[model samples]
Target chain A: MLIKRPDDIKPSDITDEKIYHQRRAFLQAGSRAALAVAAGAVVPGLMFPGEAAAQVAALQFKKNARFSTDEEINSLKDITRYNNFYEFGTDKKDPAKYAHTLKTDPWNVRVEGEVEKPADYQLEDLIRESQLEERIYRMRCVEAWSMVIPWVGIPLSALIKRFKPTSKARYVEFTTLYDPAQMPGQKRGVLNWPYVEGLRMDEAMHPLTLLAVGLYGKVLPNQNGAPMRLVVPWKYGFKNIKSIVKIRFTETMPNTTWNLSGPQEYGFYANVNPEVDHPRWSQSRERRIGEFFKRKTKMFNGYEEQVASLYSGMDLRHSY
Target chain B: MMMYRMKPALIKPLVFIACLFPLVFGIWAGFTDQLGANPIEEITHRTGDWALRLLLITLAVTPLRRMLGWGWLLRVRRMLGLFAFFYACLHLLTYFVLDQFFDWDEILKDIIKRPYITIGFSAFVLLVPLAVTSTNAMMRRLGKRWGQLHQLVYVVAVFGILHYLWLVKADYLLPLIHAAILLALLLVRAWYQRQALSTRRTAPQTS
Candidate 1:
């Protein structure tokens, strides 16, 4: 039951921060090399392809924008290919096949509820002001699977502050896009259409909470909740609602999709607690996407230091 | 008569080889990466599925013999039952080695806490006694007790169906289909039993 401190995590356990920053460079060079081979063309001028690629991949962020973790980031292919965005379908492969129909260019997120400056903002205009940072986080799903992802986004606190929430805003609710034509899974009621998720006001404002716009140095793929999504590292992946179209701050506890579907299995506070077993399956261990054997699931998904104080007095087993 | 004409040595080996088809195909699929993105899940599901299928097929042998008047069918009943046990072992091994990684404490908790695992574990446990007594020497040693003990297969089938029913999140179509097949097999046995009972009762009156 011993909890390892983030500092105690070995350097080798985490993907090097340099590798994460240079992911774009690696990808660009890889694709370029493939293209060059296909075209029977070689670099005429460039002597060091790696150096040139690094320069191309260097992205500028705010001075204070960086959240590094000691967990290895999952491959981009695995992240995009193996997703649980049930809006497209229930099967793992369904999203990649069906999410192509989604139109993300003309996207707008409507900000509403207990806020002074409640208004709709275009996806581009909204994110133009906030600084983007690359955060490596451990994403644990309720289905006993875990992944480490490098998310590129601004903190939710920055965006929430812009809206200027009233004192009555005790909680924040996020709503996903609900078009059946676009999201074919909506036709079948796998869950009540337009998946919803929420967080407490403190949790929402927590620096760890991210309003992700991109991942792995690219705009979020349609399968990975295109345009925008929430990334709450300490909680189950389902809490990170995708394709967010509406953001509402409320006083009451919001009805989340999974919690509504199976209250016993999923709770409002879906914190990644290994001790609190799901009614159907054991949560004590999780299979890291590419690994053969399961590793012990750390409480709060190894972010207990950052988020444990948020639920100081509440019993996680019951609340979960 | 055609089955009677065939030699036990020839047909038994053929049936044994045929029974191994599922395992062979499963291994081939695993090697070829045809088991898809989640290979472990695929193996677990396929092995469990084949185990249940073989158990049902074994249950069908007696009814087939009664309907078709093929006494020779009884010769392969033990083989079919053994194959069911074989697949069940593979199914259990997949869960233990691949899924659970020999985490006995977690597995024990699952067996005690989860209804699906409890039923599935019970089914596998019940099959063990029947499998142990499956040998010719043990069958002779046990005598009349052998038939009574092997009646556990009927209960095993029920647990197996319940196990499958509880495991699925939604889309009950596959489980319902399996349930329907099991029901048909059980109903046929009941009808035949009823016919035999009535005949026994009326035979003294007629005589």
Candidate 2:
């Protein structure tokens, strides 16, 4: 009963067989319960090395055109962690642990704030309208850890284009689902609830920026942003808000949690640039998760060519 | 045990051998690579664990004798204290050798700069005089000074706990438990000593 053959199953399909087998093996060994429990207990870490690439393929992103490439999708899924970012009664692992309590089936997205076509879109309606594309990108966490993931979702620009941003809109702000009764983390002041993240106009329109729905070639894990989330590579991990329910086009800079915590420490642009180091440690060096001792991190996490141009003349130290 | 024998020589060997057990087990574990992946972490943890255990054992001797009617336990206190110093030395060695690769510049910088390492190193430095004066000959030569020197173990114990507490990420339950046990043992010794002094003062004349 746990295993169901997909209606669209075909041998020619490039869905990661390794991931399917890995999940099956994990289930067959009766490790699903333990893995699920442990996943909620530990700080969600980097994916197990080469498995990131395989896991990204399984997200079924290619069928969805919103994703730019499998590599982009791979980077998003591989970075993993469906954590909703409220480090309260639940820790980093709490989302996967407590998120099962959430009801994502009847989800909806409210498109407002300087949009020509302001509307409340049901989750099912959006899925039907937009084609999913898997994009793989390097995801860098603020805590000096990093992961590559393949995420299946439509580009935010593509979705936003449908709504048509007004000429006055120069920035995009996203809000996470906020209900104290539903999201237990909101009951306490773990972080200023209704977490907000923003992007500049150019960054928002970038082809790589995604509003993700699923990862690992499957429906988004509850611990991960189940209904919908943002994937903004080159930015610090927190910039990619998860379980988004609202999007607002704004003219001013938004107040983000980390930015509010220490404005000097976290700037408006939390891009993943090795040249910009946190005061505590150098960002130039990073330890690859599974490799532990072998692999060393590279500049812009090996995507320098794609994103470095965005910060052409600015001083990294000031922005860092 | 020491009471029935009425000989200092008898308990010394047993205590010495018991003190050596942690070293032997730790060495075997390290050599066989039983320390697990990140052998460095395992070695550091194991040595630090043994050091704390021995410190607790050393502190336990007096209270254990008073509460359990096993006065002989006090005879092994010096040996256990010395063994704690031994393990603390090994713990530092593992960090310096495998971890820092004896990079003097980095090692010196860590000792001077890192608060956790400083506490750990200071505790080790305080332990040196106690270990050096642990022998019966040194005890006889120093006499009153020996007792004063050995009391440094108390400072070492506090520093050891702080070293562990500062290094932990969160959920300091284990270090807190160790601190509680040390507190309980220290309180027991103080209470028992007060009772002994009072009893001696209140006793009737032999005449």
Candidate 3:
């Protein structure tokens, strides 16, 4: 009986694809359970195991989409656990611990202001019409940290086009859910209550922008902004608002949360430009969430070729 | 008085090991992978926090001695100050080695440019001389100058708090707490100095 080390085993001896995938799925579920335990949440093991499996099975999205990046997708645990959703709290782990109270089901998004169809639409109905695509994007935070995430969503353009923006709509404003009972952090005046973010009309209509519904092939965990969120890869993560409840199109530039909080620190155009440093810290380098060494932050977070044209003549230093 | 009743040899070693506990815990946390999701930031923050905390603890020794009449507290003051320096060194090393990876040009630029980094780096630079001259022989050699040289700790503490305040984007609760503690400590020292001054004047008139 010879014991073969992992390195000594040849590719020919590898497990079958079906078995491998099944094993991977089991590991993923086990890790999620471990994460729940780590966060001091009651383990869902008492519930039917089949029910959890069925939920995972039902979450189907097209794979290897054209928009997906080649970068390694961050672990599902990291994506779910490490978050900056201030609605829950300021600490990174606060959201994972406190976001359980949020009720994402029966959610409705009200599209209003400069739109032809100004009415409340069910979140499910909005997602049902758009084709879901898996996009692996580099998400750079204004805090000088980065993560590569595989997001499942439809292009934001698809959702915005449905509302039919009038010619007067030159800017788009997004609002996060604002229930203090559910979101404990809202009790404190962290950022003038409900977090608001915005983008230029052309930027909102860009193909790269996504109205994310899920991540890592699962319905988003509450901490990761359940039901729906925004994903603007080229801009800072805050610009990609979370738990969005309303999207309004207007002729005037909307006042974003951070920009209002500290106008000197945060600007309207929160593009990921390394050359433009944040007032208190350098943006030239960013630590990839789990990695030890900091990497040079790429211009527009490496999507420069695609989105750089949007700000051809503008000074990023001033606008950042 | 209880601490004085104990032998200096035994108490000194105990204090030495106790002062090193934070660095040991930090190392243990790193090896055990318990530094959380962002290990670099966690390690950087932990070391920095310990450094500031120990510096404040070191500052509290004089007030504690005068208020509680525990002169033996002075014995641990040097050790506490050195431990503060030790953690400060670890904090700066983590930034240079792990965060910046010895990119001298970038590190230099950060020290020159970023206000938070500039103040933080200056605080570390000031600590280096105090740490170097911490030995009994140097204290003996410098005589009264040693006390004057070590007054720089107050300035270092100021920079440490400012560095923290500037770095955090929002939720300044932690830094504000540190600020309050520092303010109280400084006020206590000032109040004590005023008391000593008035006592000296009264004694001369009475004589």
Candidate 4:
């Protein structure tokens, strides 16, 4: 029972994998064909054009070059196909293979807890109200692999200011969409249903933090955490929770999924410190998604200039 | 009885070809750039998977021989053992060459200190003598000692399975499957050994 019967669809309505590929072949001459053909393309979403085109509508945003990395970004194929969205499935490829089933058409984000605005915000209205910008950032996984992703979204600071947290709000906790019907992986207890992640209020309000709505100038692919996901550039990849449904401004430290799974391996402040190796493997070096030889991993994934001051006095090794 | 009648000469080549399939297919996938985003990781995992799979398959042979009463299956066991060693070599090569990039200092550190790697590396090292003593000439030279030495395979199997168990992050599905298979095979072998000992004790000894 690796793949359970999805509740949303009648068994007959489900597209067979064979016929799905055949249909992709039939539509090969169309716009979606570019993804199937874009083998070495640098853009992230091109590799999943079918998933992108079926649900992802294009977005308009200003390019913030000051914050964006000049380094060549990994192809959309690499970013979209190679993911750590455990909600979709534990395998990196599972998201792209199965995330098409996630119904995000009428999505909403509930902003609760200590926030002044405690209401369910529609995904569309929030995107429209927030000032969107495209920022390219390097995301390093705890597994010692890295990817340069150009994300289109509003800064977390902008969204935080709009929400207006109360005095007691010390942490911002995020929760992923939870529906076993849409997310087949949720049916199994991978890391407790409804993945949870939290950041200190200051960290959440940092200028670099992004609530990414799209990727590579297009709506974020479902596999890549559409209609939106949190992208914390300086922290390990797991900190960037995807397919977020709830944002809670809390007084106490919230329990994150990975930290709860393995407390020794993961920490509350999972800043990418190359010095602090994971319990199982070394983090001194990371293989960039498209590169051959392993390169020396940098402190805070090369965002030390912007984020170092945030943890200036704190011992990263202890926090990690 | 029918399987025992099957010619080893005919089956040996097929087994050899079957053992080589994973390597050939992995190379084909590599050349096509179909190994996905992280080709190095993909290649490492594929090779490691085949190595463990072959090891498990090799372990299965003894129990199958006893259970089905196909004593002739022993003739094929050496080739399977060697193939397991061969894939294990490829698996180590992938990690050593592709992942580490000849970084001996790092490799040595991993082998010496890292529990998962330490266990896996020790298992691979244990496999070397078993592979070396597998030849018919060496088998005859060592005589009874050969059987004692090859018992190391059972220890190697435990280490190999433990290596996989420790390495996986959260998904224990595959490792658990491998553990179950190895456990069943070992249990069956132990049961057969006890049965053999009891039968020998009861039987009239001409010697």
Candidate 5:
């Protein structure tokens, strides 16, 4: 088990290798001063040298929270954009190709509509204000592919809380970056431009909902949304909007691209419950590419304990 | 007439070069990993597209030979027809071996369940007889019946176009272009055959 109840090793135990070597040498010297301190000394927490560099170099966000542990950092790296984000391009591989041109710098997210503090926030400011946590998530793409990834990002709840949504704001609407001058795909209208996706406010604020910044222990590649993206792990890949530019707290449900294209096929919730099948294909089994054969998809991608209750009263068939 | 006989051999090198070009490109692309994540799909699509195009060229020969009064086209028809089969085989191999991993069960299901696969498989199966009988020895053995047997290429061509048209989710423009070319070539053949029949009827009076 890579993670064993978190207490097996403390950060101070793994501090600068040079200092630890000196401490070890002093202990070996059998000096009275070293021995006196060594007897009741508190273990100094050690951080990877790279983490120190990252902490200093990392652009200031809402709060100065570093990744809690290295394990969390590694997990964040694996998930972000392994699946296709096709509003950017047609091919499954296209997102990585076409999204490279996306400018994530100077990102100002418009948090407007029914929120009490309806204001635009710079991405850097938004990050500086919140706590970033690492969440290990099982991501399932609608195309029947799955991956386990660790994502580093502030929780969606942290970002949403700043806006202070009014009681009338029943749903939250998210819009992707859309500029035909920069994004050529938007010119052809393969899908509705300014690709919109939505979630109920409670679902939006779920602890599992992540506003991801980096993957694989590094800042996201431009194709993977360089600065920030939404990661709704239990839902299909498309529900995880990339390079978001707008987030509106709305009273009515927002029209999503997939839902608008074919309302009968794509429902708003778009949860990854195998019980609900896509119009063209069955979602019962998914092929994790690295795995040889079919692996049964878990209900809500194994976050049933956290998310299953949200859909309890509603008929999944209707919501599907 | 003596000089014209020497000119025909010049076409052999041209024919050989044309035949080798696609194979060279396909091989080079495969070796260099230029086919991206799904090389087999790229190879399959390229070979399939070439096969359909060559099949169109093969069909065009008869109408061209009749209209231009150039009977020399009959000499190259076998070579072009074989090239179409060559690419078609490669197309099918890519799909069956690379794409399906030779899983006979899945392939059988695809053939039965998918209409595009059914059309394509039928076209390839029809091509086998045409390819087998393309030789001069078989042509001599079959005699006049050879023409009737080779008529199967027309049906194969139609199915080939239909196979392509059915597989696409959108952007029907490419298949529609193929269909238009095929219809025009078939119409020209029908017109040429009618002209030949009328010419045969008037031959005695001219003599």
Candidate 6:
């Protein structure tokens, strides 16, 4: 977040504040090392070669009971290995195998459009002040499979509030990193390059919305969209765009990648509704990752109690 | 060339074991934990793939025999065709028992409402009669009509390709390759038919 007007800062105004100061020694060490980060001249990895870059800042996070579900999480191996990151490849296992090519340590998220404090944030600087929350939620894929994942991140609303979106910010658009060299799938025309996703202003600020930086209490593996990825639990998995590079706030609804690829099949609001079947198959039932028998899929992936109000009068069938 | 010279005693057993390889590999994969996270999906996909592949292989027999004069290819055609049906049955059983867990309502809904499943299941149904009438007695009883009845293999193969093409979300490469092979086989048959017609016209009339 851009702190252009430092004078107006209040403790309450500290949007998406999470204290990642888990290990005091790490923070004390981090503060000393932050001089290199703050200097912005050198790559941290070059300065300290061959260390576990992902472990550089193991977030000290606690589970947020208010938003977390008690559902059993999928095995970490399954969660990490079986991903739908089309950037790496179209196959379910492709991301886990090919995503290592992505250079994530020196990442930057360029915030743009309709925000008072639009600025590019280094992956570390963006979440350094934020305390992490582990929220377990069910992720339903449009392909009729689902996984329960425990994601660790700050509430996206807190992050949005920090950005201080203007009234014109009716919708928030996200774009995935576009370099074909790192993301080999971009070389093929499987999807329009640089995957895009969007959420309404209200949905962006919804407490359930999380910008996930880690998975299963570890720094997110590159396959699972390392550094940062959006986690809107109530929607289909694709709506949670990975490896986001830009956030554009728009008055009009943004065009999402899947929707653009097949408008009749995918929609702007990809809420998980069993009533509306996918063009290819039935949406009513889903095969859980390891389960033998299929389970009846719930509306909004069983998160309707919290989020149904967001689309109360609107016909989900039409919007879907 | 040596394969054609071999007796049915030697060749049929080899063909039978070769046909059983996919199922054996799947069962082995299941026990060894190589079936990945979703074994059910893996099983369903493998059976379906082999079923389609065997159907194409079965379709190729007549063309290869006619073009290259490998008359012995016809000896194994029935076994190849039966193997296609075997795998198709397994593919349908995988969907009916494993994927849907024998929920008749859901299975019926899929067959009637879902286009991909409808095509795939319909293709399986078309193969049942072909499999049942493979006996020498039934072939002799039907006589000339038997060849006409067996021609439904072409229709079933086409539907099988369509079923595969419709089921995928994107990345239609595999399905399209199957479709291209089917198209080429059809073209070859049509060309052979035209050549036979022209030769018949040029010859003296039997009347």
- Candidate 4, residue A64: Cα displacement in angstroms equals 0.8
Error of 4 at B49 (Å): 0.8
Q: Give the TM-score of chain B in candidate 5.
A: 0.91
Over the stretch A1-320, how does candidate 4's per-residue lDDT look in tens digits? Answer: 01111122222222223212111121323555455334322222323434646344444556677677899999989998898888788899999999988877667799999978898987765665225667899999999999999998877766777788887888999999999888999988868778899998878877778999788766688888887799999999999999899999998989999999999999999999889889899999999988889999999999899789778789888899
lDDT of 2 at B85: 83
Error of 3 at A25 (Å): 9.2
Candidate 2 residue spans exceeding 4 A from truth: A1-59, A63-94, A117-119, A127-130, A180-190, B1-207
DockQ of 1: 0.33
Model 4 DockQ class: medium
| Candidates sorted by lDDT, best first | 6, 4, 3, 1, 5, 2
| Chain B superposition TM-score per model | 0.94, 0.86, 0.94, 0.93, 0.91, 0.95
DockQ of each: 0.33, 0.06, 0.53, 0.67, 0.15, 0.67
lDDT (tens digit, per residue) of candidate 1 on A70-108: 667788877887788888887777887788777775677
Instruction: Please give, for residues B50-143, the per-residue lDDT of candidate 5 as tens digits.
Output: 9999999988888888777766777888889899999999999987776666778767867876688999999999999999998889989999
User: Candidate 1 or 6, higher lDDT?
Assistant: 6
Query: Least lDDT summed over 10 consecutive residues: which range in candidate 3 chain A?
Result: A1-10
5 or 6, greater by lDDT: 6
Q: Could you tell me the C-alpha RMSD of candidate 3 in Å?
A: 9.9
Residues B1-207, candidate 1: write the lDDT tens digits: 565476656777778899999899989988886775567877898899999999999999999999998777789999999999999999999999999889898889899999999999999999999999999999999999998898899999999999999987644667888899999999999999999999999999999
Those runs of model 1 whose alpha carbons end farther than 4 Å from true positions after fitting are: A1-65, A101-105, A117-121, A128-130, B1-18, B33-38, B60-77, B135-145, B168-173, B199-207
**Regions of model 6 farther than 4 Å from truth:** A1-57, B1-9, B205-207
Tell me which residue pairs clash in candidate 3: none
Query: Which window of ten consecutive residues has the lowest lDDT sum in model 6 chain A?
Result: A42-51
Clashes of 2: 30
